[model samples]
Target chain A: MPTAPAGTLYRGREGMWSWVAHRVTGVSIFFFLLVHVLDTSLVRVSPEAYNAVIGTYQTPIMGLGEAGLVAAIVFHAFNGLRIALVDFWSEGARYQRVMLWVVLGLLVVTMAGFLPRHLMNVFGAE
Target chain B: MTAVLENSTDTSGSESQAGAVSSFQVTLKIRRYNPEVASEPYWEEHTVTAHGTDRVLDALHKIKWELDGSLTFRRSCAHGVCGSDAMRINGRNRLACKTLLKDINPDKPITVEAIKGLPVLKDLVVDMEPFFASYREIMPFLITSGNEPSRENIQSQADRDRFDDTTKCILCAACTSSCPVFWTDGQYFGPAAIVNAHRFIFDSRDQGGTQRLEVLNDKEGVWRCRTTFNCTEACPRGIEVTKAIQEVKRAMITRAF
Candidate 1:
């Protein structure tokens, strides 16, 4: 494809899009943190109640949900670092797109390592 | 050899202008739309005979006068000072009269469109009310509680030169519209606003640096800038927009410290 002249087309800035995605993920992780805090704070209520909350994770459906939560947290943290780099550093723009790919790679590797063990624990095979 | 070189206008050099026709041809692909007429905008092309020194404004005038009567645009100064001629030419924001035929390749067609992120009024004119509103929101002036100077207030040469580049802003809004953050969020103070704020912030003559910084410290102020540098790349006056934005950010942070 031929390159359009500078003002001809709106390329939809990568930096802006990346920052927006970071904000969204940060909000999501924040909500999950809130829920996790509530769930863990049940330990003060009763040991049995805490055990019941932990037992809910032994189901296959809940295990999948846990896997997704972990993925979201990991991706959000890695991409959050990328956003901070862009905000504070001079050379951050140079590696912005490369760091986005790195975030994706981390997301994939983390999901692969986490999902299987979570499923085994749910099914009682491990 | 000297005789051949002198007589040969072919691929060599010609003192007298050769093939430089008394009239040159230019094609202008202008984006057109009428809210009542069509659902979407379309391009209309006009071929005009232009002189070698003719600017894009001359070509637009030729089309408006000789070809199409409905073509609309804004131009106060035929020279580049008024800053009303800013528009997308061949894909970048530029003043129409400042762009000459010799500067751009005449063989390729020139595309003229309204400035980005603003409502298009007609052929090449854009509504500038929103741009000016943002400019005014920044309060582009000095404010101080101290009494007016009875005599000339003294300042060092370095202090006076601090905001020199920012003072050159013509309120053109070219830098603001070019910013990606400004395009996405209307609340953003934008580059031109920050540049104007810098004009007041660094002025030794003005005693409103803290007040201006407080205005810029709003949620939609300097924090909204993502440092894309598109504003710097797009400024016609060669102002270091991103550098000034960074300076403001540093000042804000240092003040907090």
Candidate 2:
């Protein structure tokens, strides 16, 4: 009941923001996984049923959604490794900011390699 | 007595004459809440002339004495050792006594408020009970076994160095309150408690490592920390708070297997 507007947002540096991003990307990935499981489980019913479900996902909008999902997955995977290093390595905390740059660099590289090819497969008039 | 009092505070006093440089005016926008007066909190601004050497604490003192007698805050040992003056200044947790008005860009009105993650008791004071409760739960002491030493329990220099970084804690709630998780949910034990636990856990002379690790291994304990370094950045004492909490977490993981 004593809730009151506190103050300005806490201006945390890289480490804090990374944790927030990790949480968000993690939850989004979980939801994506749930959808994937439900759709893939349709294979048991009939071949046409599973093919129809897969066909619905071949559109350009779903292609964009898949791209976003890949971006989230890429960031979460790389940042997860960074968190592990921050825990296991003695100098990890000192170098966490540097590692964040590395993780971001890796995300950019991974996304660049996957985006154009995936976009062509979805949007090309085949 | 009146003359001594007159020389004590310089609306035109200690500041203007501290050196050849005259005082300059700076504005402070403070968050104020008094249940008796207003049911809601409001932003109050007061601009006062301050010297280059003046800290945020001194500015607050000037506001309370000269501008508004109703302004209230807590402070002692104005140099920063006491830790009672921790507050959020310009969107960060810092000791008001240590943060200089000049350092925080006084050209823009500095926003001052109670440190977050705790119930605000008044203008800048907060309910420190929860913060202290977590600290107390850690058992911050040199716990040892029987067959006590006749004179003292001696520890090697190498052993002392193990926890040297954590030993600088002044119990300022700056680190704990700045934590995002603690702000979301007050149930987390917080970084200050884990840092203090690291102080005693790594002490070569202490025999309570196992018990302390068990405490930190709780559901709402070290496991809840998400490696956010806000606690490390907010510590006024330069304590490696996040590192210490990770060390406590590592100690728990090591004890398990």
Candidate 3:
């Protein structure tokens, strides 16, 4: 287990961390897409069966899961855009930390908006 | 005559040592070949006097000037910019003049050899025609469909800043030589060429992004990079070579959308 990185970091940069997060989010979104495709394909079984599966997704508990999915998608999209910017642009490295904070901020804000709706559905009458 | 005089001067002790500061003994185990003489290449040792400040280029010059005039090697500019002096010194590819004695080894002898993964032309010079052919096949220049600039074409400073880092490549083939895929598959667009492609693909003034991406989307294109980061490590100009390749990959995926 050679844990040693081959090169020194460039002034405590977060580019590597952002890169790892992008990969994780990419894989998560891919699996979610797969399950989404299968779930939508439930119409082949019957309209009733498909509605039941669709109905399960609208519940308060499922809303929390949906919120997590939204969080993953938001984080992935924002960070992916940052990576694309860094790749295409020259001064991309200079704003790498700023991009990280921006992505995190966007994730927090998206989760905040989703959680209120999710809790209202779960607790009722609020 | 100079060698004979210097040999006898060594007998005078301290005076010779002081005067000999301009030259010091070094053993060069150079790889040699002759169509008229040997069946295969063989090692030939030549003891040459080189200054301490002298690089491997100086040692080869000693061999060519004093010892054997028949020895062949390639050198131009006598500086690092030309990239013509690339050779394997002590089992690593680098420019001869760029490698100083203090950097390699001051005491032990230095081994000088031809650049690897290329056909040998003579002694130290390898054929770079194949290397250049790959570079040309990648279309290293900007190709645009838009009308020529009437005056100075307008592009935002921010857009110009996007591709500025990728434009610093000197086409030295240092990154290509340091790549493992280029060593295995000659058809693969190695890091240097792909970096150059990226330079134009992201350029705001360039309208040939689709055409260049079509060329790079081939099987032997940017996908061949295993993300080993060796090319990035070997880049002399400090280009983020892996990051450029990853950008091309991202473009391939996003363009699908």
Candidate 4:
């Protein structure tokens, strides 16, 4: 048997790309949740300690990071719904491409609406 | 190689040239590999003249018989029943015998390669041992309890219809190889294995549904499927592969509850 390489280079379409995105977002969200829980648990220690930890999230860098997290959540939610529909509905599989585009449209619209408001809250005069 | 018309005239014994056979040269860009000669697979081109209705299998036969003797592939019951000629055609897994040259863009060279995710034993033939091993692990056959009835096991039409689509699977491995998860992680049972499991699991006569579900409940089971739909698209038998996998997942969930 002749072996060119261990793994062949495969080009994936929208479905495959969506699955990759879903997994990536899932793992990112899991880690984000872990950090969120740890930071939230600081309130039990003391207000000063919680505030000190929360102060780091008030930075411009953290604001941009929050935006990326919001985008990941939006994509994961929309794509997760699409996967659910595909699993339950008989006709959902046929319109998967349409559903993906719809999810993308919704994601963009959501980010457009959310980013400005979120950034203003993060960088607003206090 | 350039396209050459081998037999431009109608050879079907039609005296009237009204529907004369039009022969055009087709270039097959086949991936060739010989362990004795080459360490890696390389592209080999062969130009064979074929009619509009000729399939990729016919072109391969023409190349093997006339152009190159060392060219190797598998084909049995060339009309697509035997499922021996499943390979990647133009980046999509398809049956070579079922794929018509005219259906694909004949002006361009048709690319033929072995199915992905499986080790190729020769030119287009892959080692199906791993694929069948997974299939066997799922226990594709019926496992009924109690004494065997003297008469045939009666099954309602609807009960039979529950698994009708999965019965179309010919163990071609097209759906399995097309799966990205299976390609990335070989431990995953793949779509074909799950589809086979669905067949027996849903069978009314089968008493092994619980055991089969337990087998698939492993870390590398149906949970690994991301519903990419590549298996559904790549299935040459038109089986609802993703749907079957989903049904199995639903069964697992139902059992859990």
Model 4: per-residue lDDT, tens digit, B1-257? Answer: 12434444546655554455577889999998777897788888999888877899989999999889899898889887888899888888889999999999989998888888888877887888888999999988889888877898889999999999999999889899888888768889999999999999999988999999999999999999888888988888999888898888888887787
Instruction: Give TM-score, chain B, model 1.
Output: 0.88
Quality of model 3 by C-alpha lDDT: 0.72
Is candidate 2 or 3 superior in TM-score?
A: 2
lDDT of 3 by residue, B236-257 (tens): 5678887788888778779878
Query: Per-residue CA lDDT of candidate 2, range B19-83, in tens?
Result: 34435779999999897897778999999878777899989999999889999898989888999
Share of true Cα-Cα contacts across chains kept by each model: 0.06, 0.67, 0.02, 0.37
Interface DockQ of candidate 1: 0.10
Report lDDT (Cα) of residue A79, candidate 3. Answer: 83
Residue B255, model 4: Cα distance from true site in angstroms: 2.7
Encode model 1's per-residue lDDT on A77-97: one tens digit a residue: 888777676556655645667
Worst 10 residues of 2 chain B by lDDT: B1-10
Candidate 1 wrong stretches, greater than 4 Å: A1-8, A11-126, B1-23
Q: DockQ scores for all the models shown?
A: 0.10, 0.57, 0.03, 0.32
- Candidate 1: which pairs clash? A7-B91, A8-B91
Model 3: residue B114 alpha-carbon error in angstroms: 1.6
Q: Give the alpha carbon lDDT tens digit for every residue of A9-55 in model 4.
A: 55567888899899999999999999999999999999999999999
Q: How do all the candidates rank in terms of TM-score, highest first? A: 2, 4, 1, 3
lDDT: worst 10-residue window of model 1 chain A:
A1-10
User: Which residue pairs show backbone clashes in model 3?
Assistant: A89-B162, A90-B162
